[model samples]
Target chain A: MLDLHNLRLAENGVPHLDSITASFAPGTLTTILGRTGAGKTSLLRAIAGLAIPDAGEIRLDGADWRRLPPWKRPIAMVTQQFINYPHLPVLDNVAFPLVRRGEKWPAARDAARAMLDKVGLAAMVDRRPSQLSGGQQQRVAIARALVKKAPVLLLDEPFVNLDYKLREGLREELVEMLRTETGTTVLYASTEPREALQLGDRIMLMAEGRLLDAGDPRAIFERPATLEAAQVVNAPPINIVPLEIDTVARMGPFGTQELGALGRDLAPGRYRLGLRAGDIAPGGPHRARVILTEVSGSETVTHLDLAGLPLVMHEKSVVAHAPGSEIGISARLDRGFVFAANGALISQGASHG
Target chain B: MYRQKYLFLLPGLIALTAIILFPLIFTIRVSFSGWDVYNPGLSWAGVKNYVRLFEDTRYWSALSRLSLLAISTVLIQYVLGFALALMVWKDVHARRFFRVLFLVPMMTTPVIMSVIWRTIFHESLGPLNPLLDAIVLGGQPWLSSPGWAFAAVMIVEIWQWTPFMFLLLLAGLLSLPSEPYLAAKIDGAGPVRTFFSVTFPGLAAISVGALLIRLIEASKILDTVYVLTSGGPGEATETASYYIYIRGLRDFQIGYSAALSITYLVIMIVALTIIAKLMVRFLVKGQS
Candidate 1:
């Protein structure tokens, strides 16, 4: 178990993280999702003991890590920039930590070779780091980290540079490897929602140095605590619209009427309604003009201008929607979310239509 | 396209031939002749000068001392420079100060530095002798003694050139990618293992280049030794160039001096060739 309590980090006198408290279970992949400069890397570095926090307690299996030096910590971090020693042969680089601990050269070499073989880089063991390609270098770095045999694995954007196929493949393999082989506590950070959703068992949503929410991946994505969380966890963004509640009118099924007394403030007043891109259906109640359409090979995303608001929807098959074409759009209310203008989620039985 | 480029190079080619090739041919011809200021004409001496060069004890001794001076200077400069570079590489605080301090010796004029060192090594009034006298050590004759004079010359050579090595190696160290060190650190490598397995090998090219430059510079050492010792005491610090100067200017043995100069050039060329071969081998092995 890894726990970070009241962790606060500041850079150049500016606060980057404010009292973040979280725990990551053993043998689980916990991904932190955030936009650029959201303190994701900073948080990871702080946890790994690379960057010191202003005020915090980092404990691994109940031992305080803040009191220990980085080398003494049982955490291994892989930064975005692959740090492979260019002078040493690939095998030696992987085996470096063991050799440092007074392991003989032959024993270190054998261990390094085994780790390199696991990463599918056995043949390049004798070559220098510079001789390998970018992907290969990243793999070597991973192998080196594994050779350290640290309990906590912190990866900061490890597969950001890789192509989609390689990224997916590595993600699957890495998750499985971490799960079966080491039972290492993995903290992976990425800005990509699909990657976070795919890799993370639990997702921590961050925005502007604040933890908005943390929960299981499915719950976090399906029911974000805040609009910011929703925006960060879904690609192409969740479509949001401001609407005034008419209490006298009939409420739709699974609509704002279910929100009882809380609908009083929203009565005949402005409220933000959110519908995920995936929740906006093709053949449903409303009709709108097809403002634009972008076709991706696997899925097609379309932008619809409805009620003077733009709503984005994703479809599994390609949709031929030309600009200015009128199209019917529908949404399953249960699958959607509604929030007050102040950005608070409208709880069921407390909001009006 | 080739014709136009060749036409542009024609004048440079002709000048190179006249300035470099022609003089080289003349020097080779003169090296074979028995010409002097008295004769003012050339006569074929053939292998006599070469044989004479081998037979001359003074010339052989000078050559041997030159070799020692070159080796010692190269070794000392490389070790001192590499040590300084490593310190500068690792230390964050006082790095700029140390860098500038190391370079001060290199920046000083060789003649001025030699005069300064000579004053410091003065047997009676020099600071070094007084310090040695106070430290329970006997003050030995520096420039006045044969052995001390040779050692003094070597010291001066090392002090002047070590900074050059430091600068080159420091640049190499700075240019190296930081990834390997980080990787080594991640692998739990201690400082010593990391240095030997990673840092030293990484700085190999720059080290070799610095050593080669020092070797060449050491072989041609003239100004400092000339100022400090003047081939002094009893020919103890006399180098090939110093001997050539003595024979050509002082003794008026111009033919023999020219012969000695030719021999010196050949020896230097052979030494440079061997160093170059070693450098190439190192590069090839590194690549493979």
Candidate 2:
């Protein structure tokens, strides 16, 4: 097991990690999910010993990791940029770590070849990294890292630089390869919610240098502990609208709202409502003016203005909602999350009953 | 008209022809004549100087001696300079001060430095002899004996030119990406292994370039030899440049010396080309 306690680091008066305390059990893969500048990379680097924390205690299998140098620790890392030794062929690059660890060259090469085959780069073993495409080069780096069979493996946004199609395919291939290394502790950092949910046995959500929530992927997605955690897990961004309930429930531009069984037990004063963009469908009671629309893959993400409040809608299929055009939309308010004015989650829309 | 653009290139063309092409053509023409003290004017002497040069044992010996000196000094400079560059590359206190101090020798005038070295090498009065005596090591002939004089000249040349190697290599070391070193470190490579696998391979191209440049400069080792040794002790330390100077200027056999100069230039070109090919084959291609 790898454990960290009170990990804190700051630069130029801005925090990169603040009192982050987390642990990973053996044989578990945790996806550190966060936005850019959210300290996901910082946390992984700290684990890999590339970045030393200002104040922290890192323990790995009852050993004091803080005293060990990066080389002394049994750790392997793949950076965001595809980093392979340009002077060596793919086979040699993969075998380098093994050779450095005193393994015979022939044995090291055999191990490297097997690892390369697993990553689907068997034919390109003789090629230099510069000769390969971006995806292939990344696979070489991945092969090199995995060949170490180190107890701890860190991949800091490894597939982020590749195109979307390549990223998806590589991620799946990586999952398959990782399945065989059952004892290795893996920390994969990413900025995408869908990737985290798809890959990680556990999800760690971070925002602005603080680890907001960490648990099972489904549990965190269904009931994020904070409003910030909810915003992080939703891709098109969950719409946050003000809700004031005194004698009755009131939200958005609509004058009144029907507080169904989901709101019956809530003693709401001034609260915030978390609405997933995918839940807001076309053709509903409320009318919204489309501000802009974007087509990504086969999905359409439209920005809208409901009365005066800004909202975003995500659709499964491509749809062009012209700017300044009025459209009728219905929100699944029953499934929305109600939070206190302080950004703490008060109740899940579905779980309140 | 488009012809005007060609006119704009005239000054540079004229400068190139005068400074480079004219000297070369003039030297080739002069090599064909017998222009010496006996025959002050250029008179056609077909293949006469060339035939004489082939049999001039002293001239051939000097050429061979020069080849030995140039190659040895440059090799020593490369090793010492690379050591010094690695020393101050990083993790040192006041690196900027040490870098400038290391470059001080290359910045000084080589002739003046050679003159100073000659004074220090003075058998009885020089400070170096007394320092050796103080250490219980007796002083011997420095500029008098042939072997000692040859050693003295090489010492001066290595000291003066090693800084050039240091500067080029330090620049190369600084520009290298830090990622490879990090990778090597994480691979559990110790210091020596990391150096052989990462730092050395990373600096291969720059090392070849610095070595070639230094080799070219070291071949023309006239100033130090001229000031310190003066081809002394029965021509024991005489190099090709000093020998050519003797034949061309001292003896006033301009035509024969010009022939020697042309032959030396051709030999240097062929030799350097072969060396460059070998280096690129081994250092760069073989490294990959």
Candidate 3:
């Protein structure tokens, strides 16, 4: 396991990463998910030694890995940009990492050709990066990184420059490669929540230079450690409502909220209710007037107003509702998270009832 | 619409023909005839001026010297300037100070630089001599000797223009895509391998660009040579441009000088064409 202990990086009197501590298991693919300027890239850079930590201990199997220089470390990285050396052929580009290791030219070329073959780009080995499409160039970059055979692989938004379909297809292929390629700890950084959910075996959600939450992809999203974590992990965003509990009843726009056993024991005070879009099914006891509807991919998300407070319901089916129509919206109460007034996840959104 | 477009081009075309075409035509006319500006007799002399130009060893020597100066100055300047650029481009302390300091030489007027260097290269009493004397190397007449005079002129040229190359190359270095460098480091590439594989290849265009500008400018340079050496010490430092200046303007051998200028122009065309070809090859090497 690669363990990062209290990793803090400051630049220009401002902290880029604040007390980031996490452990990445061997041969596991983890995605660092965050919004722009949320320190996802900074955390990746720190791990790759591009930005050294201000106060931290990076240990690789109990050894101080921070002592190794960037080049000396066992690492392979693919940047977010389309990067291929403009003066070298794709074969040479793929062979570059091996050549840097003092390998002979012809041997490096053969190894690179094999690596390219793995990326399904063997025929275009002689072609330059510019001669290929954006997808092809990114494949060449990946081939270059994979050829290094580093134990640690870091990808910083590598598919952000590509088209949506390309990103999706390449991501599937990359996850497969990481699984098949043994003993490599792969960390993919991206701001797109959908991408993180699609590709990450485990997801690390970072925000404001802090690693907010981490775990299995489903667990993190279903029960984020905090309200901010819930917001970053869910696509189309989660609906948050103010809660006022007094004895056995909870006051808020969510009238039919079932906050499990904790709901009865909670002090009669203010709190926040978190509901994932997928959990708010249509039809229960509470009624809401439809405000808008958005259909994307296989799911249709309907926006509704509950007593003037807006909420959204994500349904797997392509269901449509007209504006101003009153519909019964049910919260999968157990799938609804309860947060303290200060935004900490007091009760996880699960079958606690 | 076509007529309006043509009308809009009328003034510019007229200006181009009058200001540019007329002088070129007159020069070409004078080149073919042995019409010395000193003598009033003007008649066609066939290829006599051209043949005489080929026979003149002094013109050939000047051309050779100018070529030598161009090649050596460009080579030395590129290496020194690129090294300096590399030093200041990375995380160097006081990088801004060094950047401003390096730019001082290029910012100085050529004439001013020449005069200052001339004083510095003065035989026994100059600062250079005292510095060399302190290091057990003195008593060399810098501006009085043939070889040393050429060296002094080339030195002044390099000193004045190295900063220009440095500036252009620095911009190129800074604007390079950071992805490749990051990829290089992660790939276990040492400094030398990374430079050759990534940095140098990426810099190919700027290198050729700086070389082209410096080559053309240095080949036809005359001011520094004129000020420092005055084409003296047995005509050792007489560059092609200085030769043309003396023949066409001073000696009034207008026809011969005009013919010689054509040769210089042809050489420039051929040299620039070669450089451009290299640039195209470089740019197309790893591109679509």
Query: iRMS of candidate 3, one decimal?
Result: 3.5
Winner of 2 and 3 under DockQ: 2
Question: Which predicted model would earn the best lDDT?
Answer: 2
DockQ of each: 0.41, 0.59, 0.48
Give iRMSD, candidate 1: 3.7
TM-score of 1: 0.85
**Over the stretch B64-170, how does candidate 2's per-residue lDDT look in tens digits?**
99999999999999999999999999989999999999999999999899999999999988899889989999897999999999999999999998999999999
DockQ winner among the candidates? 2
Predicted candidate 1 versus true structure: per-residue lDDT over A57-153, tens digit per residue: 9998999988775656766777788677766688877877776767887998899899899888989998988899878888888887777777888
DockQ-derived CAPRI band for the predicted complex in model 3 = acceptable
Candidate 3, residue A23: Cα displacement in angstroms equals 3.2
TM-score of chain B of 1: 0.92
Per-residue accuracy of model 2 over A59-99 as CA lDDT, tens digit each: 99879888677777889989898888888899999999999
Task: Give the CA lDDT, 0 to 100, for residue B5 in model 1.
Answer: 85
Q: Which parts of model 3 are misplaced by more than 4 Å?
A: A12-15, A33-38, A190-207, A211-214, A218-233, A242-245, A256-272, A282-293, A303-305, A308-310, A318-328, A339-353, B1-14, B90-101, B275-288
Which of the numbered candidates is closest to the native, going by highest TM-score? Answer: 2
- List RMSD in Å for every model shown: 4.5, 3.2, 3.7
